[model samples]
Target: MTKTPPGLPLRDYAALGDGRTVALVAPNGRVDWLPLPNLDSVPVFARILDEETGGSVELVPREAYESSRRYVEKTNVLETTFTTASGVARVTDAMVTGVAGRLPWAEFARRVDGLEGSVEFTWRISPGTMLGTRSPWLDRVGEHTIIRCGQLSMAVVGSDHGPASSDPTSADPAELHGHFATTAGSRHLLVLTATEGEPLRVPDPAKVDEGIDRTIDSWLTWSDEFSYEGPWSEQVQRSALALKLLIHSPTGAIAAAATTSLPENPAGGKNWDYRFAWIRDLAYTAHSLTWFGLREETHAAISWLLRTIREQGPDVLVMYSLGGSTCAGVVEYDVPGWRGIGPVVTGNPAQGQLQLGIYGDLIAISRTYVDDGNLLDVETARLLAKVADKVCDEWRSRDAGMWELEDEQHYTSSKMGCWQALTDAIALADGAHINGDVARWRAERDRIHDWTDEHCWSEDLASYVMHPGSDRLDASVLLHAPSGFDRGERMSSTIDALTRELGAGHLLYRYSGVADEEHTFVACAFWRVSALACVGRHDEAVAAMGALVTQTNDVGLLAETVAAGDGAFWGNLPQGLSHLALINAALMIKDLAPKEAHDDQ
Candidate 1:
């Protein structure tokens, strides 16, 4: 195993994806985590996980330097400027896409332009391990040098540096290395192209360089269509871009996060894989995408979800693979995790856990789509109608709640999920969008509301408990406040209780007992903002959201958890749910907050 450098904090890395796969780039110009061919595949660069064996495409200066970075306008393209004693160089990193969309083959381009005096730059390509299991071999095929690992083959083109051309004596050498000096106004291009299970081909470097601008333009053009003109507009757009990175364009499944097994706590074995699409996350993404008036992605995600649900109807898994198939069970990798945290995992085991809340989430998407004046096909309407019926049969059963907790209980939030599902279904039926037993749905909705109000409310805590008879408070209940179950005294008091119990300033832990295991959840904080708006705490909600947006990293990316004590990031990053929550909260605050009153003097 080749020795690798220390890993950077999650906050220092920015993501660049072509809507097919994402690459995490540190400020030091290293591509740390990139899954080849697709986002869920084995990573070609896993340096973030294992510093020793995990390989990276490293481009950095040899001398001492300092750096800063930002996205190029409204794009996922990352630009890092490195300044040294001799000069400065600006590096633009992109996972290039065609003008139409993602390319048939994977192409990652790094273009560096010197801005000042000449500065020496060094780079190395080390194909360390295929998802941290084995090493890849270096070979020269005809004119192009190839690195092969299992079914993946890659080549680096457009490097004129000396060592980049040197031949390797060993078939499995540690790395290919090189150095070049950049002068003012000089531009250098390095393109890494790969293919899986097919013949390898390389495009001209000049054309690949041209593709970078086209990719940036595509991102800008997509973002320009966003209709969000609310508070935190910049961060909301950044969150949208991050959410866009997680959407698998081909299948339209939104991944929960870009990487897996980033532990919520380093010492705790809570490193769950988040590569698969949780229907809950997909539903949230769909709702937020619709909120921003981005019609294409919203429709794509909704269509894919309903299509997949129809295929697995009468019973639905909590999660599915990016291909809309059953998830492969969990596999623990041999590689050490980031910072030597062990037991890195690949797949998720919660697919079979019955998260009853998905009924509400799934039905809500159809409601949003139909409410926007679009018509659902007969098949989708039937699928949702059946889901509502399934909710009738399943809501009484004790099952995993929205957190996918192991302990099954009569969760308040799950009941609220049923209530939301039935209420939406009743509305759809009233609108003639779906055919269902409207009277039955109405009765069940009322039953759920009555039962929840009776069993879940705590006289002492003044908020809904995590479950019946449990004294614990849950922040997830905030997700339902906007649905208007009560709109009066109970929800108002619950807001104060949640603020006192689960909140740390504007941030919030997931529930009562999780502070020891993880940090305050990013999405829960955003949910609190929405809940505040729903309950008429308009000024407080705006203030809380204003402070919450400050928690995002420099490039406006968020991880799953923000450490309650110190605000350090933990868990899987560029989290789609976190970004989705931010967008949704902004929209809610914009819609619900009162307009300024006119003054007549």
Candidate 2:
């Protein structure tokens, strides 16, 4: 098989989401990656993976043009401006939201507002299913153009003219190409509505236009509730907006990231689907949202997570499907991966991995919930107690660390996480939030802490090693300083050690061994920032944060990883964990910085 040429840099794409699904719009006006109906659904446009056979929705200029884009203030609505010698045009993109909740049908609206001299705008809709397993066909329903593949159907409406070209002679007959010329003061609108199992609803043009207004209004209203007024407030709000996009409004589950199978390592084989909600990521998201005074999203996310745990009977998997069901098994695609990184796979096998850090995550979220004055329902309380018991029973056993390493070890970070979980559990039990063996939890928590201090710390290295018997450094440990596991000189020294060993300027790899293989994990860098502030390295923390925030894409979205050498983005788009980390780190600096720092700003 021949490799497809690389697409645009990962930073060149901005995301648009309406609580259910996301579309990655390229600077060149192509909707290259969109999973219809839901974030985890089979892609209807997968050109980001296989640019050759995979399809896209293009609304690009016919001539070369300089482009720039940004999200409308406090919203996910994306506006891209193309400037050419002859003319300038702006395309406003949004996934039209409903008045009450998620719209019954998925509607992606793109409005073109001509800003200057005449410019020819060309567009095409070519649909493809997951891994190209299903073929899409075009059918004209009255004046509406419908594209159907298996159970999914999409209707293209709103443009005044019909498709300029259709491959009626081809077997699949999916491509619908068209073009229109617009001068200054002229405007055109295109809306694509996707539905599954139900009959296609070709939305009226005027209704779609109104829906766009409602979507923008809804986002603005949500933004109005933010109470953050600290350093980097704009970036914090933008990150919060990005995180809001990942929230599945129907179920309140927050996906780890919006796209699937974006490579972490430039050489490939490290790609995994991040569209499902990880318990750890959800807990972090809730914690960050709570700090921002965004109680609704935090409450909704925790409620959904607890409900899922209760239904699953407390033997919590690492992650769950957005609908709170068991995730399907991993399946490899026959297509080339992003940028010819081979073996594009869907579904994550890490769903069942015993990542012991989740115990700490759940307990941290529970602590935040109760501290915020929200009482836990009986079922959730019981679930928390049961999970705490499991942590107590399993803390001594070797398990996967937070990095989800394949080799199970007595990871020091995992032990610290369990220590954190049991400590919080005892606190909750004492507070009457749940009934548990407080005495036993206290004993185990102390023992875990003592064991970590004795074994994890390396006097030789002057830092905590990855595990008891290993010399490797893992960035996961940096999280503990802010988690309250260790905030003393030891952690301070560990921060220095981590920066000396694993830090690539302000970026960091997950562990020592993978530095040559994968991009630096963006979340870890932010964790370091938080760790620095925790240890009272205020100047260093502020400087580090300044450098890290500069890594965000043009529209303020961060991917999962970034190239250590050049700071280019890799991995999943609009990573929730990365954004959560950024928000938390900014808040940490704000709280820890001396009064002079704030006065200086």
TM-score of each: 0.97, 0.97
Expressed as tens digits, the lDDT of each residue in 90-191 for candidate 1 is 999999999678899999999989999977988888876865676787778897788888798898886444357544675438477778889999999888
TM-score, candidate 2, is: 0.97
lDDT of all predictions: 0.87, 0.87
Candidate maximizing TM-score? 2
Model 1: residue 590 alpha-carbon error in angstroms: 0.6
Clashes of 1: 0
Model 1 RMSD vs true structure: 2.7
Q: Which residue pairs overlap in candidate 2's backbone?
A: none
How do the residues 15-76 of candidate 2 rate in per-residue lDDT, one tens digit apiece?
A: 89988999999989999898888888888788999877778888988888999888899999
Q: In model 2, what lDDT does residue 150 have?
A: 79
Clashes per candidate (backbone, < 3 Å):
0, 0
